[model samples]
Target chain A: MIRAEKIFKNFGDQAVLKGIDFTFEAGKTNLVIGKSGSGKTVLLKILVGLFQPTSGNIWYSDINLVSADKESLRKLRMEVGMLFQGNALFDSMTIEENIRFPLDMFTTKTLKEKKDRVNYCLERVSLEGNNNKFPSEISGGMQKRVGIARAIVLNPKYLFCDEPNSGLDPQTSITIDELILNITKDNKITTIINTHDMNSVMEIGENICLLDKGKLAWQGSKDEVLISKNEVLHDFIFASPFLQKLIENSK
Target chain B: MNLNLFYHFGNFVIWQAQIFKRPENGSMYYKETVRQMYDIGIGSLPIVFLISIFIGAVTAVQFYYQMAGSLIPAYYIGYIVRDMTIIELAPTITCLVLAGKVGSNMAAEIGGMRQKEHIDAMEIMGVNTSAYLILPKLIASLLMIPILVCAAALIGILGAYIASVPAGLFSSAEFIKGVRSFFIPYNVIMMLVKAFVFAYILTGVSCYQGYFVKGGSIELGQASTRAVVYSNILILLADYIIALILTA
Candidate 1:
């Protein structure tokens, strides 16, 4: 339900995203994967109205996010939920308050209703009893879970996750990926995730777009990603010799 | 890594205007003001009081060395204390205190939140992040700092009295007369206005610094330090301008 057309973004002398085009389908995980500084975060920010594209357009079902008004952006934003890379929980707030923030700002729900929804979101992320905990008191993995819970608390139609696996350990990364996949399936929400985690692509990425230096290098699912003989894609997916050898052995 | 100070100043104007435009937003501004007073004024009372009292006592002792037993009227000590505290110490030093306490805090909190993208989260949730964040600070400063300075002034005068009365420096009635002799209602109003202006300097510049903090926690910390230093300088400049106006 999201389409970006010929989007171009630059920072001074550096062209970050150049002439990129993509469409995201509803009810599936659409991932944009790349190395560091590959413009994944910028592209995500553009789609979510945090940054304006230097050129081209992003359509969120019809309205161009790059040029939307404040009120319209706010309206569109209400339908979108973002899980930032750092979890971004307000330090002044408890876990429950963090989860309930969107509800407090966007919904007129009664206190009881808001609390129930918070509890539900917390349970969904396996954080049911940690309502009163501050962010500094929580584990990094738990914080990521809290981030996911906050992202979905508003029952948003669109979900965007940026580097969801950045600081998590390998095992926790997989669990978080699985949690994202399960949530996407259950809610049937249009989900987009930005990551460099190859395992996440293989595990939960139903639709994948690989970006290399602001250019779209490959677009496919797990099956296609594995079987493709494209050299650039191969180098990207198996840049590390260990993974390359492991994938060769698996093949 | 990019910072445009003017753009941030523009953001401040827009945020403040929006908060004042809507009634609910305005009420929220006042409510946030009260909350900030508890944080900035009430919480910091002990330090502010003790500092002023000690400063007044020390000053009275020091000034007595020059004019204690000579031709100068002993009760003039109260007048000197009143003039100094109201003119220089209350507005400027109080702002300096705030620069350390609330100024850095506002920058850090908002900058920290900005780094976390909590500000963006607030924006996406249909809340006016600027109004919710900065307006409260602006209003709080306007409402609370005057009271804080007034309290500081009262404590200063009392401390000066305590320090002087034991030495047969001045009778209480005579000191009261000296303080009242040249009382200017306009001066008090001018001092209050100056305090309000200083509050804005402390809160506004700090909020602007915090709101634009990019990168991560490290950048936010940098923003906090910059906010305090920059706003401290600005508060002094504001002090000079207000002094020019009131004394003109």
Candidate 2:
């Protein structure tokens, strides 16, 4: 479990995250959902140590991430994995090499062992035979899967994904969501995903935190979403007339 | 402007400290260094050859024209060409050109990676992005640029031979005699010293510009331009300082 304690972030007098206190539970898809510019990305970045909060403590279990020293942070990073919004796979590397990068950098494994791990990751992502293909040669959905494979190749204890479904179609987005959900359950990893996709929120948002204008506005599960009385959550989740009408009709 | 200069200089010094840290994996750095060597060294051969030849030809031809009917012997053209190429033109001109070619390319490549969030991805994976990205390029330039400068000096002397000897401006023997006259081995050492310093400036400045780049493609383009411009200015400045120190 990862706990964020009174996290306050400010960029030159403009506060982005205002005293957000929350706990992301292990073995579940913990979602941070909000409209654009609602501090979702900033919160996620702070949690992953990409950005330091202006004030507050981030407890990755017992360790305080905000105060961890360099060596400690380095060790912690090995147990951490992230999937970028752009699916930041190395364009120059093949799918197999991309998946094997972490192992090659941080392991004492021999070439055969590394290759075996790479193959296993590829198979796990359901891109079993597409080892030699470069990222550009694959479809966007396939590239997302490759990103997932690379992220999980290290068997990280904590997984952070930033906007995993931004440019993907709804169908592909759902597939990616399911994949992440399964990976979290299978590995028992503490997974925190930053997304605004309602389909993702309704489908696999086992634990959800809603931010409105840099403050935590609502918090609940997918089941609580449809019946929630939180105005901010309602405005964000049912922003479109169609979604609002469907929610109303279903009620 | 003064404050901005100090800010950049201070940041650059701090960044250098980060870049020289111990590598996470020696073999990975070695592999990257080899790749960079091929890119910065072999990839630059054709352009270096073309420029060096012209530099030698022009220097010899211009000197010969000025020395015509003077007290100085025609053979001095070869000697002058040899000294100039080795002492100044070969290292300085070659590095200036490479600041535009290799330096700008390094900036763009790293800047593109930054814009694409590749660096962030590596950082999240526990890689020292600064050391991993810049060190290999630095090592490659340090090892390759001096060799390239030496090649340029030799090709430049050959170019002088081709332009002067065959054109009947002087006999081949006279030019050869002039080349053999001023055999000061110390000048070659000076040339190498300049090459090493210039190599460090170009690579470090370029990598620094790219690694800290922010925003979109336009910003990246500006960073690449700054990398080349700053590298050239510093190279020339260092060239003057080194010449003074060595000559003194």
Candidate 2: what lDDT? 0.95
lDDT of 1 by residue, A1-251 (tens): 89999999998989999989999888999999988888899999888877888999998888888888866776887788888887778888899988987776657788899999999999999989999999999999999999999989988889999999998899999999999999999999999999988889999989988888999988988889879997777887888888878878999
Clashes in model 1: which pairs? none
Number of clashes recorded per candidate = 0, 0
Query: Model 2, range B58-126, lDDT digits (tens) per residue?
Result: 999999999999999888888999999999999999999999999999999999999999999999999
TM-score computed on alpha carbons, candidate 1:
0.92
What DockQ would candidate 2 receive versus the native complex?
0.91
What lDDT is reached at residue A76 by model 1?
Answer: 84
Judged by TM-score, which candidate is best? 2
The TM-score measured for candidate 2 stands at: 0.99
lDDT of 2 by residue, A111-162 (tens): 9999988888888888999999999999998999999999999999999999
Q: In angstroms, how far off is A153's CA in candidate 2?
A: 0.4
Q: Which portions of model 2 show Cα errors greater than 4 Å?
A: A247-251
Error in Å for residue A62 of model 1: 1.1
Q: Quick one: best DockQ, which candidate? A: 2
* DockQ values per model: 0.52, 0.91
